[model samples]
Target: MKKLSSLGLLFLLILFLSGVSQIAFAAENPQYGGTLHLSNDADWDTLDPAYASGFDAGEMAVKFYDGLVRFDFSSNKIVADLAESWEVKNNNQNFIFHLRKGVKFHNGVEFTAQDVKYTFERLYDPEVASPGTWVYPMIKGTAAKLAGESAELAGVKVIDDYTIEFDLSEPFGLFLTHLTLPYGLIVNQSAVEKYGADFSQHPVGTGPFKFVEWEHDNKLVMKANQDYWAGRPYVDQVIYRVIPQPLTDIAEFEANNLDRTVVPEEERERWLNDPEWSDYITTIADLSTYYLALNSDFEPLDNPQVREAINYAIDSKTITDSLFPYYVAANDAIPEGMPGGSDLPIKADPEKAKQLLTEAGYPDGFELDIWVSDSSTSVRVGGVLQALLGRVGIQVNLIKNDWSVFYNTVKNGNAPAYYLSWWADYADPYNFLNALYTTDRIPFNNQEINSLLKEMTITTDTDQRIRLSQQIIKLADQVGDPYIYLYHTSTSYVKHPWVKGDLYHQMYTADKLLTWWIDQDLKAESTN
Candidate 1:
């Protein structure tokens, strides 16, 4: 009997050890030769970053293109991406860049200075009609030609095969930051010469990922570029699916088929309470301002009292609470978290709104129409706003449009006192305030705004420039330029529990993909 018992005990102990080992292995971040999935609010149906105006397209661009300079998310300063280093001289009039020595385009051709010159010249070219054309006009003929008013770009010059130079027409603080944008992404002269119009369907760049193929409104695949100058990207593949509806995104993500998604406000509570959701719901206060852009140059918006009444009548807190409980209120036109962001003023006085309305000749209130996108976030807020304004005697007719179609229509300076939001493309306040308001030229700018923009652009002192920016925000408040004040919004995402690296918010227009990687079990173990 004693011998039998000893044999049984030995067997039990061996089984226990085997089970413990399995448990330890199961808790690790599993890495496989697989795809990392991401979903967006809508399908940004373009592969060419130059013509892809929306940020949705911008997000995928880091996988397909390279820029002259990249922003260091940690420092919010300029760093090298394609060009190894650069110097600003000629008394701040010229910027000369030295390209990386051995960078190769996907086509197997060496990337050179000619590509940089071509990028700027194309933006101003009549055929490209690039959305970023307005921001680069100082490069000489680029602006006038892009606006269809001229035929040549002036300031861009190729110093040599590895050197590129630009002469700024004036002291524009955000020019370098703008160059780091998707518009500034360099494509191989060889690739363009090879692909022609089909380049939109297929592109090659000195980026971390290379284009595989686009299956239309289904899937877009990008495989790791093994020969990447930075080093091979950690994820093997990145797959993007065109799940247009927000609910579809949530459903697909919950099914473990996707890695990340943009959660709209309507479903916020439901998703927050779900058992399947662990840490996946991501919410961050987007460095954006949600406000109504009044065509102050025309219509009811031209009336200062009309604009002020609309502003005062808005209960930014209530709408934000009912829809996005995770958001903050807008104190000014400029969003928070950038230089000079705090200088903007804040207040919500109904009496002040009423007084402005009365002074503008409408003691009995007025009728107005407001346009907004039909996404859950935009629609929910628009609904709440419509009701709020109704209470204050401003009967606003709300119009909801498709996102792309909506932007195209409203951007023509005919935007009908619509609800829209703006995010800064770079680190500086100049990018935030000046770009939209200073353009009193093409679409036309207000004289006051144009003059203020000129002063802000020329000022060299950092502190003085910030003060001038504050003055611009103050001026915007006094006038009803961007007429509505909604709440400041927040966004949060669940990051698969293993992804690591800098999640940059001010990535010009997109997040960096090169540094991000999955935590393979070999390196670290997961608690779950």
Candidate 2:
């Protein structure tokens, strides 16, 4: 009897120990070593930090590049990345950055202040012709370099191997934020010289991930930089698969092939309601604006009255509620939740629209072509607008083109009107105003608005800057009539249950991939 009791006790003890072990395993902190499977709708245009402008390329660049400053997604503050610290001197005209030591590029070259100088100089180099050149206009001597007056930027000076200085032409409040952009990402001078124009295909930088292979139109693979300054990333590798079809992406996510993908509009509700998928669906309010960009150079649209009529003809509420339930109807150019943003009353006024059309000498209606990318959402939106504009005696011919071709066409001012969205490169009102309204990217040009935008850049006072921003937005609306502010999008992504870490950011879409981890056991269970 004693032996039997001892044996039973031992069995119970073993069971308890096993249960404790299971609990411990479940509660343990994330373990590193799994590939994160991600998908994008399109292929990257370029990997070169200075010239990469599209979102797809920018996301990939984040993995392999480090900027002087970085925007912390959780805190929403500008924090040090390559530059450990910085100081604003000379009345905000001079910025002195103390670089972090022991950092190395993917190619094993030591990062120094000279690389920072080289990066900025290359941006100002007329030979490179980066569209991002507009980002560095405040850097002193940039104008001279662009005009062939100088070879080097006078403002960018290397104080030492670990310190660099930037002398601005004026006190630009958003200069630090600007440095956080992808354009400000530092590149190894030797690497650029080695690859030359082919550097876009083979990028090397001092980021958390190192470039491994880029199979164009298929996948761009990256491996973890074990010697990263911030500690190696949790994931072993990141595979960005190019899957253009939205439904196909969702299907792959369902099949456990893709760890992260955007939820298609048709399947969003189904996924939101499913108990299995409910926890994986994340909706993020994006700091972006979708609009119909009107070219003032295009006849009829050149008339402000006709633009106002087009804006009034479309029903924003219908579009937002029916087509894009995740989006918020926009009334003004500046999105809500930002400084200087307004929720002005903007509704479809057919009577006022008709009056404006008559005033613009289109009383009998007219035909116009509106260009859009071949994305399903863009096509649907265009179709809706076509129906609405037809009621107002305006025929809207929807012209769909491939993403790359459409972007190039619009950028070249070949499209009289285009459907597009402007995402914030940084969390600032200046980025929105300057990029959309002030740049030559849009045909609408107003001298007074331009002068106010210039003032907004230099204005430091929060209240004053807000006031100036609002004034600029109002002026653009009145004169330029550049865009019919449609709605603010809510970006939704479906993450597999095993994927851990925050993924949503106001300014950057891919920064979270650096810290994200995969639970091997859970991932295996899901797959099995």
Candidate 3:
């Protein structure tokens, strides 16, 4: 969205010939009184920032919550959000933040350093079982606190009502970057206490928008916060209507009932080539990687040679080539353009694959079941994989499950193989590498990678950190073999010409909606 750097040159030439000014038409001036209509295919999991791990939940969380620090796409850096300013102390091992004054949660409770302390402690709470504890591994007493030996997060110090300090056990280079995630978003203790278990349904935070209503499987609405620390959002209201299908979302957008909708993979080419729709196509190359996960805990796959054989069997370049403009072949663990991202010397070799399978005692190939989520993209990708692996004498049975079943199966390490993607929470190579490799998600255990990942966190030098991460990635490819790197994702959306200041950012969970405003005159003109 920033510059269309990844868009096809031929598409740009088409736009030029058709007299279209930009990929996504944005009005020069903004009008502030319209409701921004949008559609989501699934319902939000939760509104509470701490428990919101799914993308849909995060999309809602960013509207209703404010993290200490947030990604600033305009500058492509981490900028202060709730904290007015911050300073590093004790040789980058401690962070002292000066909080903004007079910020109020949706429930009208004033925000303070106590809220920050409460939020981190809540994340580390053993009873909570939150998925966010990984974001604060460098903090002092993290192990003890998570192990339930300590009640307090000793590192989190409330200096005063308006100031807070975090003492890290080591000098973590991405400390500020980690704080940009929704996990670091501050919440009022009183609000959480009041809602108790229902806190997720009723979120209270000091963001640009306040939660108003949610009709399950229908629509969720948020109104602009009049007393927001920052100025109010340009749009008076933001509405997310749940339209279960991509085709329905596109239909709603065409009917002028929705502001924008994602272009389905099947429909992207037609929309891109059609002169009538080409101008509205907004494509963003995100910091994400889609891959085929081979669970090492499972038999046969546990053999490194078998894993390598599987990798060599599938032609990733060919798959990505067919999905052109939407994706690029992923050569390494880290995505291209990010630090430590590189092109690895890996390719499909049917002969080598067959040789390795025989060496691993699977000469006639073996039956393996690959669980796939019930999304259209995942199913389509699974079919391609089934065909590719069959070529090398490996029979892959595709098991398509709904999101809940697929997620739990993978999380519980029950899936021998699965199709998944990793999108960045922060624009760091560490986020991608640490998430896919270290977690039980894929059950990959590489001592070399594990040690390097630990060192990567505390390494303050940028180049040194990059080198360590790159080494870890290469090791994962050569030895770990947990996943067959597929492709990096690019998302395209059809946006209305009246939508102003909307940018498809790398950090999609950040509050991009606050900057978007509807051009009333243009909307009226288009409607006429």
Best of the candidates, TM-score: 3
For model 2 the TM-score comes to 0.87
RMSD of each: 11.6, 10.8, 4.3
The estimated TM-scores of all candidates read: 0.83, 0.87, 0.89
**lDDT value for model 3:** 0.82
What are the per-residue Cα lDDT tens digits for candidate 1 across 173-193?
556777777888887767876
Candidate 2 accuracy as lDDT:
0.81
* Clashes within 3 Å, all models in order: 18, 0, 0
lDDT, candidate 3, 130-184, per-residue tens? 9888789889988888999999999999999999999999888789988877788
Model 3 clash pairs? none
Worst window of 10 by summed lDDT in candidate 3: 1-10
Taking the tens digit of each residue's C-alpha lDDT, what string does model 2 give over 1-528?
Answer: 011123223333433454454455457687899899998888899999888777777777888999998877453478888999999987678899999999999899999999999999988888888888878898999989987789999999999999999999888878988887778899999999999889999989999998899898999899999999889988999998999888999999888899988888777778878898887776666678888888878898888888889888877877887798756777766654557765456658887788889988999789989999998889999998888889899998999999999999998888988999888887778878878876575677778888988888776677888888778777766673678888877656788888876345666633836657898999899888
lDDT of 2 at 455: 82
**Regions more than 4 Å wrong, model 3:** 1-27, 127-129, 142-151, 322-325, 358-363, 374-376, 400-405, 441-443
Q: Which window of ten consecutive residues has the lowest lDDT sum in model 2?
A: 1-10
